[model samples]
Target: MKGKNIFQEKETHKYDDIIHLPHHVSTKHPQMALSDRAAQFSPFAALTGHEDSIRETARRTEAFLELDEDKKEQLDEKMHVLQEYFSEKPEIMVTYFVPDEKKAGGAYVTHRGRIRKIDTYLRRLLFEDGTEVHMQYIFEMDGEIFGDTE
Candidate 1:
């Protein structure tokens, strides 16, 4: 004997006849591929290169250190020792500063190689594999080859 609400009753089917009808076909353009259709809804970047710019800004680099006269003298003496042992193909570790291409600061890198040639004309120390380190940028050099060559 409970009364039913007017809105709660199921609505009569009005368009049930055409509801199952085939979708209308277009005569003008061919159907788009499923992948292409899905791509239309994919996320898009309105600001081009924004992410790259932010990443470049966030990139960090080290500052180059200035060597004092005493340190410079020590480096010079080491270079002299290395030059004497150059013919022996001495294995050494050379630490040098490399300037950043895009930032104010640079970085220090250590290279391990056998000395091939010291090009005073180019002011660079050449390695066996053609790697060259500028004399002005060299911070330190260490090896057993420089031990007894006083």
Candidate 2:
């Protein structure tokens, strides 16, 4: 009565008789489990695969780099030095680019391992753990074995 509005001024309780009555139980069906009941209000994905497509589109990758003649020569010199010290089993860090399987470009990854072998014929650097890094993919190499060799 203190805050009665025009719409409610003349209105009476339409369900006043049933307003205080307890809620009726459904005898036709048993009570639903809490998990299943909560799932009913959970969000539904109307567009299937839409999120995956967006994620794939938003995924980023790097382009493969091409080293200039001088840089390439320098890398080759470093490789030669590595090959010479291969028998000594030197510990070195090699940075190389890996092409993406699903994209046009990829990324550069660095690996630190002992020198197992430098297969010139196969054009790959083999590690003690049987990891084979392609020579062409190598960006730079550094270790104590390459001391003062530049």
Candidate topping TM-score:
1
- Per-residue lDDT tens digits for candidate 2, residues 83-146, read 7877789999999998888878999999999978878898998999987899999998899877
Error of 2 at 87 (Å): 1.9
List the candidate 1 regions with Cα displacement exceeding 4 Å.
Answer: 1-18, 148-150
Tens digit per residue, CA lDDT, model 1, 1-150: 279755555444556778899998789989999999999999999999999999989999998899999899888888888887778899999999998999898889999999899999999999998888999999888899767633
Taking every candidate in turn, the Cα RMSD to the unseen true structure, in Å, is 3.2, 3.5
For all predicted structures, in order, the TM-scores are: 0.81, 0.72
lDDT of 1 at 93: 91
Instruction: Assess candidate 2 and give its TM-score to the true structure.
Output: 0.72
lDDT, candidate 1, at 92: 95
